[model samples]
Target: MFSFNDLLTINGISPQDVAVALHKPANTSERQALCTMIDEDFAAFNAYQSTHARIPEATLKARGIMASFVMTSDGRMTFVGLFANAGSQPFAQAGPHVYALFVRMTRKMTGPDEVNGRSGLEALQNRLLFDLSRLDTMSDLSGRLIVQDPGARNYMRVADCTPLPVVELTKEAQMTPPVPNWDALVLTAPDLRKLPNSWRVQLSAWRGVYLIVDRCDGARYVGAAYGSENLFGRWSQHVAREIGITKELSQCDPAEFQFSILELLSPAATADEVIGAERKWMRRIGTLEFGLNT
Candidate 1:
């Protein structure tokens, strides 16, 4: 049987680093006791191998694309963390593949205890940081993610064991052409939450007419921002309330909402003018009859 050390050697991690990880205390309470965890992770991994025959061999040959399987034990979700080429090359040279981003798929949690930090996927990276030492190399790719919730099952793995579809992060996002106008910028609720600081600065500078389109039901809500904080401030209010002006908005999943600017007005725009534009939009879209506007 391959002890953790033998597994590390097969995964291309150095002996010196392996020794440090095993003996070192990751934190005050938990020492780096990864030997058994690694075994368990692999056992889960191997269970799927009957279908993915090449996973074990391919993982050895592929140098990039590290992965983590974050499974919620309660059968609510299965989060897959895909690093472009995490272990195939040196850390510094891996380019954008070095950073980690998490995706949450499926049911919502009832409390913060379900996740290590604040509820939602936003805190996923922070949770991953707690396991930084174990994720140091490809050998530790499949470390178990332990959290306060027994319902959460988090494990990191090489991309090879179960090849997941890659979301192009680095090159494509950079290559995306900039939106020429604020009216053209469309944002999802999650995108708005992750809105860049620079973009927020520009948005905060003006009042505007905006639209909230619910992707799930094709409902539309027209609203205006003419307050002192301007469009950015108004949107921040939406984030704060986490709902829209209508009863429909209050009930619908925020993930189903898409926000966009209809028209941008000067900072001097009055509240009446903003509201007038909003009403015009509602009328044009028949939001009061068919959508969420009240």
Candidate 2:
């Protein structure tokens, strides 16, 4: 039966003072005192660190204190506290308001696994502290884009951008035209994996999508076969034959030609939605490639 007195003694605070700071009436001192006790206990529990050593003072200042108790959707007790702020006053003065805000935020953001069947306030406290730290680091870009390299297990901030001018080495160099192949194109394993196993029944189905990409100063065609399997092999062969015949007979050597299967989309999905998603990915990949090349 831990009580407000216990919390006050541990944190060097008085129960009555906590009540006053929290703006709870002394007549309901027991309830106010209990709330303060829980808040302090959770805060201290979250503050402890192991491998990371001490938490930075600046981080604490920014995110405020964390707690070891989290409120659940079903109104049950969990030993996990989330990142929290105590406002700009002592626990007694700001405790109630902060606790209410913490409860509200937890209800909105967390799922059942996070707030259920947990004990050991320290564990909950530590998890929340780590989360807060990560969020703070992510948000502090300092006006630059922050990207993570999973292979290297590190992060980098890109700050500068300088474009290189496209140059033509020879004055007689001519722009090569593209050769479009009406035939089928070969798809990669990743592209093939996008379609479901049931798509094999409809062999002639080609309602997927296509894109024109610039690769190595040449145009490359990419197509996807939605709800279709074994289509990539047939399409690739067809495309190769078409390109071979057309480029060999053309006066101007066709620009380097290549093709790939991007991805399969749902049958009901719209072209605009699919294209929007593709464009977003392309932009990201293009930015990374440009940065690496430069």
Indicate which candidate wins on TM-score.
1
Worst 10 residues of 2 by lDDT: 155-164
Tens-place lDDT per residue, model 2, 199-235, is: 3233334444443333344433333343333334344
The digit string of per-residue lDDT tens for model 1 on 21-139 reads: 11122221111111212232323222121111133324333333333333222221122222332232222232232221111110111111233322333422222121121244442
The list of candidate 1 runs beyond 4 A from truth reads 1-115, 118-180, 245-248
TM-score of candidate 2 versus the correct structure, residues matched by position: 0.19
**lDDT, candidates in the order shown:** 0.44, 0.30
Q: Model 2 scores what on Cα lDDT?
A: 0.30
RMSD of 1: 15.2
Q: After superposition, how far is residue 218 of candidate 1 from its true place, in Å?
A: 0.7
